[model samples]
Target: MRWPRQVMSLLVVLALLVGPPVALLTVVGPPITGWPTSGQLRAWVQQPLTEQTLTAALTIGAWLIWLMLAYTVALRVLVRLRSTSALLRRLPLPTPLQATASGMAGAAVFGITTNTAAAAPEHSPQPLAAGTTTLHDDAGPGGGESHTIADADGISVADGWIPRDVAMQVSAAASLVWLRRRRNYRPGLTPGDQPGSDLAPLPRTVASVQAALADNPAPPVAPSSYAITRLHDVLPASGIALTGEGALSVGRGLLVTTLLTTQSRPTASLIISNAALISLLGPAARRLIQRLPLTIVESLDEATHHGHPAERRQHTNGPRQAEDTPGVSGHPAVVILDEKDCDGGDLTHLADLSMGTAIIVLGRWPAGPTWHAASSGHLYDPHDLTVPKLRLCVLDHVAAADLLAVITPGEPALGATAAPVEASEPVRPNPRLPRQSTRYRSHLSAADTPRQRLHLRVLGDPQLLIDGEPLTVRRSAGLQILVYLAAVHPTGADAAQLTDAIWPGLPHHALTGRLYTALSDLRTSIRDACGLHVIDHADDRYRLNPAQLAVDLWHLNAALRHATTAITPSAEVWQAVVDAYPADFAEGRAWPWLDPIRETIRRRIIDVCAASAAAEPDPDRALSLLQAGIRIDPYNAALQERANRLLHVLNDDNTDTGIGSPYRR
Candidate 1:
């Protein structure tokens, strides 16, 4: 009963195979003498065979062999039927009644044609006459012809099937083999089937798209010097944030970064109702379409045409295939519906049915019919473990630039181009805002005069000292650029020098956009934090305004320079210099450019300490300064000797010669 369908199929095949043979045996065997009757056959099978009854045993063995052959045929038919059923599922089929009627009519027509052909069939073969060639459809290269024609329908039929009777026979044999051996047909047992795997999250698919976009070559234009350090704070993971006028660029950059950094790139369907928004995306968006595996369609008509036209037309009156609909196919990981006119109907039909698909709605602010206190503008699913509904991200100017860079890869983002600086003009205050301008005056003085001065501390950890308060820069490139400009001083460094210092290994041309961004970020940070713009540019070189602020490193060097001209520099002056330079220049930072400056500061400190020690009258005090110099520059041989001499003067117990002097180079 458990395998009744299989059993019945097997029986039908067996009946066909065995019925004719058994009928012939029953009819013909009776005429022949010594034919085994049912009673005699049963008695022979029941008893053990003896030498005297060997003839009856042989006859009974032959009949058993025939039955075995019949059973084998039956099993082959069952296997063939199973295969047919599987194939039928993949094919488009007519209604049951229609198919049955067609099959019956075709069978009747085939029978008539076969009978008519048989009645006219007798024909003699003729040899080809000289100078004439016969073209046979099945002729071999050897000129031999095949007598039988292959079925025309057979050519159209898919292969991989055994005849019903043959398949049945094979199945029966397979079953017999399995039962008899009680072991696997192959060397090892078949492995257990694993459960079906779940589809990957849609975000993964989007990320892949984002990556492809990022890898592409950018457009011809270059990005402007626009920077915002706190982009990440405004746009967090898994939700949308609104950005105002100034933050647009930042928002756009974050969007692109988010798209690329997100773990998954699921299939996404973008529905945009506003044509203007699409146009505004420009080349970058166009490039993204070309790069990502995205399908863009506006209306239902376009969706209907996704699959075969004939299939769509045939099912126009009924429910269409899920695949025929854009997002429903599940090929896309997410659906982006940007329709200005998107309503409850669209959401109910498209987004709701989309279910597992992530739906990102754009432009339309108000909720449709689906919006409820519980729905929260997003249709919730019990299975959805991600953020609710669509994440609304605002793409600002900077964000757009980032998106452009990603989508185009090598292209400059929109609005990134810098205005051409006039060749004749040197770097000066902005003409748009004169020194007397109220806003400019306001920035200069919090009250009557500017409350904040340009305060830079680069002796230790580099920081922007604004009004005696240290302000840390979030962007490392900006900080590095600022430090380099400060180190070079009034003369500053050209674009080439800055490029070499900032990005040593990158190609010069590729650094333009990045350099612009760094400069912009530095300027922005300085303006916002210190309420001053100390950086000035001229002849393609950059420098910091010394008049506007003071730097510790600059002061240390200035003091040292003055000390050389003085008749006799006081100990206090030397001490001040030593104390002013607390740590190595650009300490805690690891940059090749910082190495020389850091070493220079170290050497200056050692010299100052050594000179101060030599001038001191007290032997113990002189030894202390010498020891300080030795500690500052352990590799300085001259400083080491000074320390040794001081130790001798002090008459220290450990003043013995060459006892592993700490200052030995």
Candidate 2:
């Protein structure tokens, strides 16, 4: 089969190139050819053209035209092959595989079919339609998963797989899409009337997502909903089932259910069977479930009684009172069940419970639409012919933990700690040079001094301030680059490192122009506001100009360094470190690269708070310090234990007196 197709493709190419020229030669190159010689040309032109002469001339003209058309066709085909080859070269694949795929693509373009069957059925969970395009993920380059995309149009090429950073970008883009849709939807607006209806497809790249966000800022939504909405689009009044035994599928289902519940207005609630929660959500269910807006019951019967309390209250108040109840029908109550938990269970009562309630089942259901999720991150909706496939967003355990940590609301700021203490390193007097003349000193100061220092704040909400006045950078990438430079100040990052950080998974060469533009914008913003060149570029590396910028993170690190090295750790130094932590580093921004740095900064500050509390002499002040640390991280076991012990001691002291203890639990 393969040999026949290959042979046919070669024959087609040969026909296009050789067939026309050969036909022209056969008609004009032989002895029977009636073409006039150069010597007879003048005499033939002078004589009136005969019918035979005209016929010969027309025949020659037709053959020439045919040859030119053949050449054009061959040129276009060659151009297509060349472009396809270039695209294949850009893919992150082994040389041999890339070459094989390139050849396959060329053959496909020429109407040569090598093999139509989907290869590696073991990796693909769902059966792909006969002519549908599928991206197969085998053990990719560097032993990671790689995707090879093949379409029904006979275009097969290796498209690179998604990495963690790209995954986060995709998630963020999905959330933005969801938010935009939600914001633009009105009571009677049709799909065409909705805002962003004519917009391009959802952005799959980091740069595109950033650009989209800049153009239309994503409206804020519940943090849990924000995370879950990334997984899939949840229909408000539809029943959907996810059928797959894979962890990714199960997790996606759970997250989608959680998202629906969180989006429920007034007070969100969920009725998930106990078995489903324990078996499907696994060991960490208890901890995570506590934070989610849901309720666990033994069975569906108990769920019925617990569901829609607000609706029940309305019915009791009066028939007319139902109209006044907010969020009664605005958000659908969600019920999630596992196949094992709902074996032979009756779901008919679900309809009787409430209108617009969404039901999500983890496994096969006898009713409603079901989607199958593959381990390769493809979600297949066999029932929907129009849109049969989608890239399913999945969060692994670590990513889920990161999202939860980010969304967990920090306690309100305890009144400011002691004023920030300057680093204890004695300020060395300026080197005593020969004293300048008064006139020279005045001239030098007037020529070189900056009006105000540029302050770069990355801790808490990222902000750029000049003399304490906030400055807004319109370009998100520009601000991100500035923050990155501040984080890695002095040493700086080269172009490659910067590009990888700012636009992860994108080609560095392709992004060079955009990177230059962002860098320029950042420089212009700083220069225009403070008349200072804050970003320094040298030896192809970019860094913040130390003389022109003051970074809060730098100050925090300085205080921490001094506090750690002191002979007797000073409480004041530790307090300075605690005071310096306004919030988590780059809080509210979910840049994937910033996660590790944010966590590191957070843990360091928590340690400092604990150290400060330990160094305090007074019990009251010690408790206060511990509380401050607790406010920073409520889930920190050490801080909670310390605070509990201190509280107990104070409670005992007060109990010994006639007065009662206000601190008693």
Candidate 3:
């Protein structure tokens, strides 16, 4: 049933459309005496030649079958839809909570009730079960070590407090605050990773989670979501790896140079955990929510300790970043301590550190990079595949530890009491990524000689650069910012000049550091290879050492040189120009410099195509060249319109039969 996946959708549609029509056809008809009226009031029940009876019986069966089929098809279609959350959100608010709230509201509405016991949800602040963690936590692992029990039954403080059910929904909404689609990947399962099995290497927390789902004996339920809500029982493992970019061979599709390596402009990653509910909400719901201007930020500033009533009660009013952390941090921020005593009252201490905030989560960690984690509170060794750099970020995503858990998955998470990491000690750099800092993240690898010049490839729209080896970058804008400097006659373009060139409307101060980071990457890639200053700022000139680098633009310069001045044109010259054209100038970065290169190469490609078609008369080759040229200049009326109209001239000239030459086949 290798149906293009599209056919499954089509089949469902067909069943829905055809089944109802068949039901209607069976019902709408001229009746032949109408089923014989139960054999004339039970007198002629033995009669066999009754057309009306048979017809009516067939109709009834047909309608029933049609209804069943339609119902089945509709169900299948709904299940396959990308968003399905809205349909199932009809569950009633909790009965217990609803009853309690109704009772309280009734007292106010009717004015006939005695003083009520403090309403529920006013002060009943329970803790997560032992050995569990979820994103809702404001401080690091609370209870310091373990939460103390305070009989919370019948606990209340306010006259009119929110219902428990409403509170639960509000808490759940907090989880959805910084929602983003998370990519789940496991390393060993990737083709060609078997030999590395049992390495016990550390990956990012997100990667750990991905590996968990991948290696799980049970089938995965869904992709791209936060794990199950019951955090204590079934914590979805996250992996650890350094953050950056890599080219996926993805069967045959490769994005080599489109500058995708440097993540420049990032799109919003929305995670719809309840797909069914999200589907029902649709774009309209998203717009409405965006318009709401919800200020539901939970502050982490000035939050010192955990599990203290004052700390917890007053905790909601802290720094905006703290409250905002849960929304965007991409995982739960939990603080772990030894105990809830005043000394480590994870709550009070949490308050001081918070500086008047709850939680501020504004990083692009996908439930974050990984650390050593437990499956069922036991040491769970993970297979090694996640690149090492992104791991620490992963663990920090979920665990609210005093210090980050930076070890592999099986290793025990280091607690706050562990020896302090010396500020002077050099950090062990990320293994998955080369040690390149933001200082030069955006410059091009300045190759010192023609031999070191990297090759350029066009996978689709954008072309990627490979200087002896592929380069990895974290931000696309950084890559673009780097490439412009790289592509420029690298005598480094001034910061002001480059900014205006790349982003005409953007202010200098806002993008200067970011652009500087991208150049640093280019600088590092160049340093690692050809050992040259890719971009240097001196005497107000942003210059690239041409000795250290070569680009498609320069190659095109050579091709044009060979084509325009050669007394007699050769196939090699035309081929050189054709080879120089890259599908995309910058893979992921959208900047102004790319536009000129795109159009320039585009016209040059057309010139080569037309020249090749004229110089060589093979129809297949000519057609291919022309078609390639046409792709870029589809609306060009001059070349195509003139050539097609001069078809007779082209047919008659066999030696130079291009699109409209005077030559015949």
Candidate achieving the largest TM-score = 2
Model 3: weakest 10-residue lDDT segment is 250-259
Q: Can you list the residue pairs that collide in candidate 2? A: none
Ranking by lDDT: 2, 1, 3
Q: Over the stretch 36-130, how does candidate 3's per-residue lDDT look in tens digits?
A: 56647475466745885576677667667777877887887787673446433421233354467658766775673354455557754655232
Which candidate, 1 or 3, would have the higher lDDT against the true structure? 1
Model 1 agreement with the true structure over 504-613: per-residue lDDT tens digits: 43346656766776677667767776567676675556776666667776777667766656788887777777776677678776443554355445655776786777
Query: Model 2 over residues 357-435: C-alpha lDDT tens digits?
Result: 5566677766556777654344567767565354433444433433332222221111122121122231122322333
Which scores better on TM-score, 2 or 3?
2
**Best-to-worst TM-score order:** 2, 1, 3
What are the candidates' C-alpha RMSDs? 36.8, 21.5, 30.0
Error of 1 at 348 (Å): 77
